[model samples]
Every structure is written in structure tokens, then in C-alpha cells.
Target: MKFFIIILLFCLPTTLLAAEFKVSGYGSIVGGKVLSGQKDPAGEVEFQVDFYDYAYYDEDWAWDKESKVALQLVASINERLDATIQLVAKAADEWSPDIDWFYLTYKLNDASKIMAGRRMLPMYYFSEYMEVGFAYPWIRPPANLYWWEITQFNGLTYLYNFELGNWDFDFSAFFGKETQTKIKSHDFWRNRGGYYFPPEGVYISGTADVTWSDIMGVNLAAANDWLDIRASYFSTRYTTTSDIMFFDEIDTNGDGIADTVIERRTNPDGTPIRSGQWSLTDFDLSFYGLGGSMYFTYATVLFDYNYVTYDDGYGSRFPTFYISAVYNHDTWQPYVGISQAKLKITRDFDGFGTGEAEEHQIMTLGLRYNVMPGAALKFELNKFKDKGDRSPWYDFSYHNDATLFSVALDFIF
Candidate 1:
């Protein structure tokens, strides 16, 4: 099935060349070794299942090889429209033959363009072309800012590029739904019934409902020979799923006074009230941010900061920062950086019952060598520490004093 799709995409009509079509792919083989007494955070964490095992390790401290392969096809049908599709293969066979991107773009004019179908979110770098790691300076993009899971959305986009006086500006707005799949994992909290073992919770279950999401932003940048200044702001939000509750006051056994605690149920009478599973109330969320990058001779420097706060009374705030520099000498690029993340939990959690706040501080250093123009090799090492709550459920105390070493090869054609 995958081979057939690739063949069909390549055979599509295009006027770029009279009788030739384009096909390109790249692969990476990676290994790593590490030493630490802490448990593996990725493996034991109950909330994040797919992100675990991202680090390579041995029985005590060993290295494992991982691979990533990508193929892309582009067909220019006319002067205004072009079609593109990208397929990816990875180390996990269960998730293999993935569709990285597929979209048809129409150029409305020299300054405006519109794209439809499954596309990358235009909100951040390393998102549109993340699999091609060779284009980046780090072995992996900073985990503090880039959680690096599925940042893509299936939707429509409008982009406009223009120049005003001395500054170049580009603005984009997008609306669409995020594609999600059922995650197969064990959750002890959801299996209270003995007859059937069904998954539970929004963070753990795969059958979580879908929601409409949107992203809109603008970028303003100015550059001379020695200095460049750029700044951008992006906002994104997800619609609330049906059956989601804000805060519920429940009264059981026909009692007039409210006695039970529920996050989404409200009671007028004293009967035991259970909220149905399909009430679409308001549970909206949003994030606002500003950041920039700077480039210079021999080395490129970066400093970025962003704050995300929830709209409702839940009171969740995430403040993030990343500062790093890399020097490229045609053959080798060496880099080092420090990143910090603070997750503030204002409303006390009830179900999981962890604590109030969580914080993470990570320091990273790595180097990338250009084996060739289109291919590169990378070696990365990371050390992470958690502050505030030392609970295993919240902090990485499951993986307490954690360290990791990884190597990868990335390419583009």
C-alpha cells in the first residue's frame, strides 16, 4: 500500500520538466551510550507514553541505533499551483510509512499564497521541515521549547509576504483540526470496572475527542551586513470537547445541600446528578508569545522567551526560555546552550493528586559535522534537573538525575 502511494504521487503530471518527475529521500543511523542511577523518565511517565524511549540506553548504560528515512514528491501543474507529498519511515515499524506532509499550494500573487490539506503549522521553526535535521545546528531542537511531538494540523492556511519601508514582514493565519490516533497504553486509573477494561482520562486515553484549532501570527525582520533583528508573535487554541466540565456541584441522595465535589456537574434538585458524556460547554485555551534570533560572523547567537497562560480560572502558566550559540566552520558546527521551563499549577489538581507546581532546568551541549553538503552527523548530550515538587508523578524523579547521549545522521535532497 505504501509503495503504491509513492508511485502514484511520483507519476502525477507536472510541467517543471517535459518527461521527468522528482523523487528524494534521506536516512539516518544513530547510536548512544549513557551512565546514570536515575530511572528512565520517558519509559515510566504515565502521561507521556510516545515520548518515552526517545533516549537511547543500555541495561545499565548502553547505546542503541535508530533510523529515520523520508521521501518527498513535488509536481508543478501550472504557473500558480503546485502539489507536494512527503512520506517518512522510522525505527518503529508500527508507526512506519508515515505521511509527513501533503498539501497543494496556490499562489494568489507575488505577495500572497493559500494552501489546503494536511500541512505543517507556520508557528515555529523546525516544524515545517523538522525531519530534515541536517538543516539545523543542534542534534535535536531544544526540548524545552520544542516538545517535538505532533505539532502539525490538518487545515487551511493563508500567507502574505510584504515589505514596509525598511522592514520585511510576513503574516499567516490558519484554521483546522488536529489529527489524532488512539494510543495503546495501560492506565490503572481508568480501569475501575471488572467486566471491561476501557481506557480513561484525556492525557492517557486515545479516544479523546477532536477539536477545531487555529494559529495566526506575523513576523517582522530587518537585516544589514553585521546585525539582524527579528521578532514574531503566535497564538494557538483548541476548542473544548463535548462532555468536558468546568466545575460541577453535585448533591446525592435527594439532599438539598450540595455535598459532593464534581468539576463539571451542577445540581438544582437534590438527586444524584451525573453529567452526560456529550455536553459541549466552553473549555477554550490559548497561548501568546514573542521571540527573536540573531546571526553574526563565526558564530550565531539566539535568545528567546515566551509565556503561556490559560484563559479560564484553572490558572496555568508556562514560561519558557532558551539561549544558545553555534559556530560553523564549513565542516563542523559545535554548540552549547541552557534552557529553563516553569509549569505553574494554580488550581490544585484533584484526580491525579500530585501537587501545586513543577519546574525543569536542562543544560545541553553537542556538535554536528557535515559529512557532506546534503548529509550530516550529530552527537548530543543532555543533563536535566527538576525543582519544586520531587514527586515521581510530577517531576522526573522517576528518572531523577538524568543524562543522555545520542548521535544521528540527517539529510535532504
Candidate 2:
């Protein structure tokens, strides 16, 4: 399906391309590696020791993780109507093409417009240009705050631009829903050594059928000469049904009963079992953010703070913030930032010896050089530290500090 779209994009008539249609593209060739980190000799734990790993870097100095190219087509359907289609190919997906945006916009007036189709969720200040690396000052946005399962939605949005006093205001409201499938793994019942009954460790893998519905969001921003301020609120109801399969289990210490009672699809005697369904239904999740940046003649100061809450009795509240200062010198820019993410988990549902809180701090120094028109080169080094309990989601065996380095060539045309 995606290949067909790519072919169709290039097969358009030359007259239309020259007259009423505009075609443009952007791309990035990014590579990074973990410079220093802890190595788990047991080989059972996978830690997010670097930004590259967090971005799914699979090889040393490879462009197959955060590298991507996107082509966009904009056409004027009428005096007040326009159509846009954006197709993206990402190295992380084996260079498979996907439709990033296919939307129609109608101008309601000089200050208002309405759009319908697939579009980015305006949940943050940079949500609209999150994937356009050339538009941001950092090699990547603050991952701890911007990370989420869903980035886009298929629905409708209304935006209005207005000015009050000396401030220019942009307000947007959107309604949408999304459905996605995700694979998750855990190693709760086994330690480093693969021991016990099955002898492969009590590792479990599962497919989660997750859906976000009743999604509603509103974003407002006001900007003037030197100050830009933005705030956003988003709420959604989510449901997930998981089908988990356990790979190994054991009866250690010669006990007649199994020490772990994980759900499985079949019994040891080859009889079918039906007890591996886990569901989180109609849970409420909300995100709130308020932050902005200050612009100066030779330097820029950026800051943002965000909070997320989940209401499934796990008592999950995530609060994160980052502050950065960038100095601009001709075509070169150097920046430094400090950020922190703290997760407060009040419910110890697993009964393990894990604590109720986890925190991570990061310090980053980077330089960006505008090599030419619509092109930039970036180099960044990051120092990361983990504090408190291990994260259950990543199966990190222990707390460790690490350093990461990355470089990328970002371009738009």
C-alpha cells in the first residue's frame, strides 16, 4: 500500500506540479552510540543506557534508527480549500513507507481553519514539527517528556489565530482516537541465570491490543517579540487486552507447588488452558503542560515542564522538566541543557522488593552548525544518571550511569 502511494506521488503530471501543486521533502541521516555504560554479564537485562538505544539504535554508527525521509504534497483544491499528503520512509522500519499525514483543510475565515484526516496530535509545543529535526535546536526533543505510545490521530481539528494586546495567540482543539498493537516483555520470575523447570528463565512475552478513545485535546500558545508561552491539556480513555505466554517456569527447592503462578496457554501435560488474559479497561489518562522559551539577540533560553497522570490505581504520576541555553554565533550554535524525570509509583502491586519511586537526570551539551541552506549538522554528548528503583517496563537489572554521543545531518528541501 505504501509503495503504491510513493509511485503515485512521483507519477503526477508535470503541469500540475508546476502550477497548482507544491512538493517538498525533508530527511535526516542520524547515527549514535553508547560511549560508556554498564555491561550486564548475565545477559538477561536490557537497559536504556543511551539515547541511541532509546531511539532503537541497533548497530554501531548506523543510520537505521533515527534516520528518515519524508515527502509532502500540498495542493490548492479551491480558494478556501487545500489538500496535503505526506509520506515518510523510516530506516527503523526497514525503509518502509508510511502515510504520515493525509488531510484536507478549509479556511473558515481569516483567523480560523478546520482540518479533517490523519494529523499530528498537538500535545506539546513542538508537536507539529517533532519529526522535523531541522526545526528544533536539539538533536532530539527531551525524550523523557515527549515519549508516548501514540503520536498521531485520525480525526478533526479546529485552529484559530488571533491577537490580543501585543500577543499573538494560536489556539487549537482536536478530537480523535487511535488503536495500536504493541509487544511487551518482562522477566519478573527469574534472575540472571536461566534455571528452574523450563531452564530458559521465566521470561514472558505478550501482545497488547491497546486502544485510546474519547481523545480530546486543547492547546494554546501566545508569542511576542522575545517571549513565547504555551500550555496544553489532553485527556483520553484507554483500554488494553493482553495475551501473555510464559516461556519457562520451575519448582525450585523441591517444592511440590510451582513457585511462580504466571498465566499460560497450556498445561504441562499438553492440555489446553485459557488463563492468560490481562485487561486494563476504560482507564483515564491525562496530560498537562505549561512552558515556553525566551528569545534573545545572541542567545536563546528554553524551558518546558510537563506532568502525566494515570488513574488505574497504580498511582502513576510522571513529572518532568528541562531547561536549556543556546548561544548563536553566525552559522554555529552551541547549547547545554539539564533535565530530570521522576516517576512516583504509589502502588506496589507486584509485591517485589522494588521501591515506589524512580528518577533519572540528564545533562547534555551539543553544537549545531548550519552547513548550508536547509541543512544542518549536529553533534551531542549526554551524561545520564539513574536514581532509585529499577524500572519495571525496561527490565533494567540495576541502576547505572552512562554517557552517549550522537551526530546527525538534518536537511529539508
Candidate 3:
């Protein structure tokens, strides 16, 4: 964070000194907590949503989980070329600044453009402005549908805009790979595999790195005055690895009972040891998404759906979706939504597929008050219920049916 903050301080202002530079920023000061910990009969005390494992909540309120700030810089080098850079710092990762958007776009015509560099992957309706909390009525994006942590890629993209009768269309396609060298992958599921049995919640302090390569995808969005629709598809070669050892119970007969111990790593004397490592390489995975929104006089209705599948069956066959409705009033917005996620199938090193059709849903109620232009104050309540017997996806897997409260001050500058 210090390193990126140094760049933001020293580099952004220097770019602004150029003749065609423009600067802007956005941020969210948010706090949230788990309210129903006692209601969790098993006494698991912490909670976290998908992908953001680094940030979580417990019985006490915490601001560090989701607060963040970002600065954006745009420079028009020439009439046909432009450079954009956005640096974001998240409190959860100790204020580490991420180079979220460091891309250059070249205008081919009034309606077509091409870009190369780093940018957010267009997976959802609000992907481009995901970090700008003031843009959305809710405190954050819906967790179930927006679960993946790999939110961006470094590559080249082409975009075209056009009109077809009553609707406007945005067409975009991209091919690239993630620039992050390592990502946490296998730890979440393995810790929950031994449901209703002993030895659950295996704690292993190590890295489970996931990599995506040869990525190609397309997004198409169409909108009119009152309605909009979007669809996207992506295919990539996924690889996962870890340098540590992996351990699990043997259940070869699929009897849901441990017959023996499975070991992959050995010590110097040939004794087995590990920290939960699995190797799954060169597998093809794909994502499918669809979304629609309808605007009425007093209310807006929205739905988003996503599905992910792996051809090798080593990855999680995840499908998630959500629907929401927001009521707009004078300086006030109230919303309600339901979101769900299903892990149809996911495998571990010992053939212990923990998230085997593991399912969960969240119901949310939130209100947004416009504090002023470019700012808003929001309150939200969410009820999380796990439908599967395994556990809620978190560092600890003993809790279920948790409720959380959140408050936030969001602004743009």
C-alpha cells in the first residue's frame, strides 16, 4: 500500500500538470457487523461472503472489511488516443492500492474503439464502476452474483456502439490474462469437507494460487429509455497449484466416513505432512451471464444471473443469481433483494468434494438517503441462510443463518 500510495501521490499529480489531463476520485467509508452470532447454534463467530476472504466480520462492528478509496486520471494525448489510470486502495488489504484501470484506448471512429492494458472484466452490469459506492443504491454489489475475486485482466479489447431502432447497443470483446501472480483457491472448500464428521475446518497456513490464461470473452448490452439487457460469455484455461502439502480423510467408497488418512507431501524422513495443496492445470472453464433491468415511474426491477463450469470437473460448477427492486422517492431510495449461490460440484485433492451442491441464499433490505450531490448515506440489513448441511463459506464453517447490519457514507469527487 505504501508503494502504490507513493505512486498515486507522485505520479498522478505530475500527469495532471499535462495540458489535457483530468482528475477524479471516489470512496466509501463503511462499517458492518454480524448481528446473529448467538443465533448460530454451533457458535462459529466470524462471517464472510464469497471471494473477499481477506475481509470479514464477527460479532463486533468493523470498518476495515469493505472501506476503500480510489483516484482516476485521464489524459487525452491526441484526438484519437486517450490514457486512463485508476488506482484503488482497499482497507481490507491494509490499504493496498491496486492499479485497477491502467488502459489506453484508441478511437477508430465515432462509434468504435480499441483498448489495451488493464481493466475490469465486464462480468456484470456494474463492472465498470464497481468500486464507486455512490453509484449504487445498495452499500455494495450483490455478493452472490459478484463473487469472483478475479475481477480484471491485462489484455486488449475492442468496443463498438450502435443503435437498432428503439434501443442502443454496446458490443465489446476482449482477450487477456490476469496479471496477479497468485490467488487463494482451494482452502475455502477443504475446510468444510468433513460435514457431520470430525476433523472439519482443517487449518492450513499456505497459498492456493489460481491462474487464468488464454482468456477470451464478449459482452453485449442493449438499452432503451425504460429497459436494458446485458449478456456476456467468457472462456479461459485455468490452472491451480500450491507449494504446500495437502491432507484429507480417505472416503474411497463414498460412504461419508473416513477410512484412513490421505497424504500427498512427505518430510525429509519420508513422513507425510502438508498444508492443503492441490494441482489442477490446463483446464477449460467458461462463464455465462445475463441481466435485465426495468424502470418504472416509482420503482426499478433488476435481475442478474451467472454460471461457471469447468470441463475437467476439477473446479467448482458454480451458478449464482439475484433479483432486486428499488423504490425511488424524494431524496430517498429503498430496496429489497434476494441472492443465491450453488456449488454444483467442486473437488479437492483427496476426492473430498465439499462444496458438492452446497447452496446458500441472502435476503437484503436497504435504504439510501442522498446526503448531497456525489454523496449518499446508506443502511442495509442482510439475512444469510445456508441450505446445505456443510457450512457457510467462511474461514470458519460452523455457523449458519447469520444476520448482518451495515452502514456507509459513499462519495465521489
Candidate 4:
């Protein structure tokens, strides 16, 4: 692996292009030991479903582990244009490969650029730097603050980044599509509460029969030494044959018949009557986020406020914030941060979904101790607070709230 990295680095053009070729990568292993409080009727039920790249559990001692590998190739293909290709693969087991990123960039200058293939969306403050492991101050970005939106898009993007005095402005326009065999609900986890699940082959709201479709959006941002700001708007149209599921309708299939109870009728004698309406109504989802960060020698403060709304007319709006302070050393750095996400369902679909809009928070404190020049060990404690209605789990006690203690070794080559 080292030899392969070295050869790839040396063979790429350097002087003529005046561009440099370099290789960088990061990997880490995290283990969690979690404990819970008296079960909260409104907290997470028994969570045993796999989420994204992490594991789930019903027991207090379940540990979550993950590993990843990546490669970045940068070439000064020419003076007016430079190119960068990044590829990453991650796994919890040796058999499967998770392709995280594969994209090519073309730069026109410091003020403008264009990119094609698969790349990160400009949705948040950390979007562009999410994978730059060494640039962040946390063991991992605050999950609560991230909202976990899918980041990669396949298509074309145009961007412009410029600076006026100390203030820097960033703007972008993008278009792309995602294809799947089964369309899954973007809010699949909303109804489930505390537990999160990886979206697989499932028709969303019974509408959008095909698993995927295309998405297009525009974003704008500006940042200075002390403050940062961003805003984005997006729209997606499903290209499936399934019936569209609305808050009041659940025609499970798009066959043009009303299979749900509310839309059905009964005769005067109480005999049931069928209604013909098996199609789901299609709608769009809109998102808006604004936030910034402040830096101090003794501490760094970051905050983000976000809002999400569905076109069907029901949605959630929330604010996620983070603040952390670090005392740097020649070889060891210790830091602590408070992260919180408070979402308000704001509005609901009359009789369709239950539970009032509420807030959820997680407090974490951790340390990073360098074991060597390129390796370090980190330990963190997370406390969770759930305030809302209750739900049942597979078999375990109700999960009102919980705490997790985790430690990991992070390294690079």
C-alpha cells in the first residue's frame, strides 16, 4: 500500500503544471459503551437496526466499530485547469466495500470552478470539509447538529468563491439525479422516533414507485474570520409508478384504489364499501439552514440553525448548536463541546401522525491524546435527553433517554 501510494505520487506532473500531486488518508476505530436512564415512554424503543455505517443495539454494552480507507489524486492537468479525484471505501466487515466519494474537479481560478461526477453538496458549513479529518476539532462532528442528510450528488455543479477584505463569499448552482429500484420515505425514521434505520428498497409514502429520481438546488454562503453564513433551496421529483402516500392517505400500492381506513366507507347497516383511489399524491421537500462559527485562542464556538419543510405542507424546523474549547500542546490536545439539536414538528397532518413537536439534546465531552506523530486516542461521553410521547420497542424497556461512553484510535498514512 505504501509503495503504491509513493509511485502514484511521483509519477504525476509537478513543475510544468506548477501543481503538486499528494496522497492523504485517515482511519479510525470507535467503540461505545452506553447506559440508559429509567425508560422514557417517548424515547427510543429497542434500537437494533443498522444505521448508515454504524451498528445498533438493545443492550447497554453494545459496541460500535468502523474502519475506512481513502485515496486523493491531484494533478495540474493544465494552467487554466486543475483536477482532483478522491475515492474512499469503508467497512465494518472485510467483505463489503462502501464507496464514499469519486469525483473530478476543474478549476478556472481562485474565483470560479466547475465539477462533474459524484461530490458533496453545499448544504452546511462543514459540507466541503467533512472528510478533511485533520481540520476539525471534534472526535467526530456532532451527529445531532448534522441532521444526517444524504451529501453526495451525481451531475454538474458551478461555484464561485471570492474574498473582499476579510469576508469571503461562496455561491453554487447544482443539478443531479439518484436512481433506485424502490423509493423509500425521506422521513422513514421520523415516525420511529429515537431509532434510525438505513433506507433500503421501500416505496415512499406509497407514491414514487421507482427507488430514485433527480434533485436540483442552489446555495449561497459568506464567511469572515469571526462569522459564517449559508442558505440553500432544493427540489426533488420522484419517477416511480407507486401511489403517492399523503398524511391522510395510505393506499400502500399505486393501483388506484383507496386501501386505507379513513378513505373507506360503510353502508347504513355497517357493511364496508370500497373506494377507488390507489394513487399517492406527489410533493416536494424544502430545506433552509443558516449558522456560523467563532474562534478564540482558548476556545472555538460553532452554531447552526436549520429548517425543513415538505411540500405536502407538514414539516419540522430546528436549531442545532455546538461549542467547544481546546488547550493545545506539543503532542496532546484535550477538548470539550456541547452539541444540541432541537426540532419542532411545528405542524402536523390532523389525524395522520401523532406526538407534539419537541426537542432532543446530546451533551458530549472528549479528549485527543497523541500516541505518536500520526496517531491519537480519543474518549468521549454523551448524554441524551428525550422530551416527548412514548412508544414500544421490540422487547426491551422503553427508551426515554440514555448516555454513551466511547473511545477510539484515529490514525493517518
lDDT of 2 by residue, 1-413 (tens): 33544554565454245437889999988887767765444332222422312353322556677789999998876678777889999886678998889877899999999998778887766767778999877887766566665677778899999999999999989998876655221222234332112224433333345577888989999999999999999999877654435644567776776676545655689654322343434579898988788999999998888888888655677888889999978699999998888777666655633344667777889999999989999999877677646544344333346677889899999
* Tens digits of per-residue lDDT for model 1, 324-389: 788858899888988777766566545533343567766779988998888888988777665546
Superposed model 3: Cα runs more than 4 Å off = 1-18, 38-43, 179-205, 243-277, 280-282, 314-316, 346-356, 389-399
lDDT of 1 at 383: 72
lDDT of 4 by residue, 1-413 (tens): 23533454465445325666667777666566556544434354232222233343333554343345566666665665545556665544452444454444677777888876667766666766665545555556665556443555667888998888988998888888654323233323323323222132221232123322357888888887756667776666533343322124456798866477343234458653211133232455555766566766655666656665545533545556666666566466777777665544445555434333455566778777888887788877767675433332221112246676767677777
Q: Assess the local accuracy of residue 273 in candidate 4 as a C-alpha lDDT between 0 and 100.
A: 28
Which candidate model has the greater TM-score, 1 or 2?
2
Q: Candidate 1: list runs displaced more than 4 Å.
A: 1-20, 40-66, 93-95, 184-282, 347-356, 390-399
Question: Which candidate would rank higher by lDDT, 1 or 2?
Answer: 2
Model 4 lDDT at residue 398: 22
For candidate 3, lDDT tens digit of each residue in 82-111? 888899998866898977788778999999
TM-score of 1: 0.71
- Please state the error at residue 335 of candidate 3 in Å: 0.4
Sliding window of 10 residues with minimal summed lDDT for model 1: 189-198
Return the candidate ranking by lDDT, descending.
3, 2, 1, 4
Each prediction's TM-score versus the true structure: 0.71, 0.81, 0.81, 0.68
Q: Find the candidate with the highest lDDT and give its number.
A: 3
Q: Name the candidate, 2 or 3, with the larger lDDT value.
A: 3
lDDT of each: 0.56, 0.71, 0.75, 0.55
